[model samples]
Target: MKWYSLMPGILLLGLAGCQNFPALYSSAKPQITTEKIEQLSEYGAKFATEYNRAAQKTCTKYTRLYQQGDWRAGWVLALQVSATNNKHCLDNTAAIQILETLESQKKIDPELLWLTQVHLNWLKELEQQTKSVSQLKRAANRKQSRVNELVKENQDLVEKLEALKAIETSINQ
Candidate 1:
């Protein structure tokens, strides 16, 4: 009677062992479900909208400062605007591309990738220009320092020549 009662449990254990449990758990890669992709894409769109609004505000601030003759402040604001714009725009676009790729179950579209790359290139160019401008400002400061030193040296030479003339006259007298 006890053996009969344990038979079902033994059968269940045998069946479980026969099942391909490891194959179910092991995959080449984890895949995102369609629902999750859609949810994340929606979030990306909302983030882009918020970022756009923030970029507009920064741009307005930059323009205001520039017009008010505070150019350094304006430049700083402009850089901030550019970086923010780059993040939101690229993230939004990339999210769309990824969603499309996963939806179609295909490889990534190079054209869509290029679209994001172009914006990145532009940001790089902007950064390079800022660096160049900074270098020029530093060079100008160095040149100004040299000019000040030359002016002081000329004054010292003039005073010394006058003192030598006075000394010569006193000795002769």
Candidate 2:
């Protein structure tokens, strides 16, 4: 019927009207400024430093746990620490790259430029530390796996030796 056809059209029109199509289609870009970039870089550096510090603490705790034979928990903690460190590196790298790009495009103040360079150097150091931590985590996991395997093999050997003794005792009886 005509009413049913009109209902669908009306619903479609109402749905379209509810959506802010103009806002979605607008081509306006956010204004970028040197001050904003500097602030962002500073914040990024602070965040990275905090994250790295926390990760280091976690790593230390897990290292102690690992020494105490809680390998599974230690391994999981190590992986989490590695991931946190990696994320810090990624975030700082992105902020540094953005600042570098801005510097190339516009004239940044000497103070801001110096600060950016300092942040870049710090991020680089963090990256190196992250890499070292990851390497150590991997090595520890490998060693733990080897130790687990040796313990399992020893248990099997002991069980087999017990069975052999039992058989010998039955034959003598």
By lDDT, the best candidate is 2
- Those runs of model 2 whose alpha carbons end farther than 4 Å from true positions after fitting are 1-90, 103-107
Lowest summed lDDT window (length 10), candidate 1: 71-80
Per-residue lDDT of model 2, residues 1-173, tens digit only: 88997998999999999887656464764456778667756644554455467856644554465457553322233223225334422254544454455457554544456655665566667768878999999999999999999999999999999999999999999
All candidates' TM-scores? 0.37, 0.45
lDDT of each: 0.54, 0.59
Candidate 1: residue 102 lDDT (0-100): 33
Backbone clash count, each prediction separately: 0, 0
What is candidate 1's CA lDDT for residue 66?
48
Off by over 4 Å in 1: 1-112, 169-173
Error of 2 at 152 (Å): 0.8
lDDT of 1 by residue, 12-112 (tens): 99999888765646556455467745754564454345546785664455446545765333223322334533442223333333334332543323323
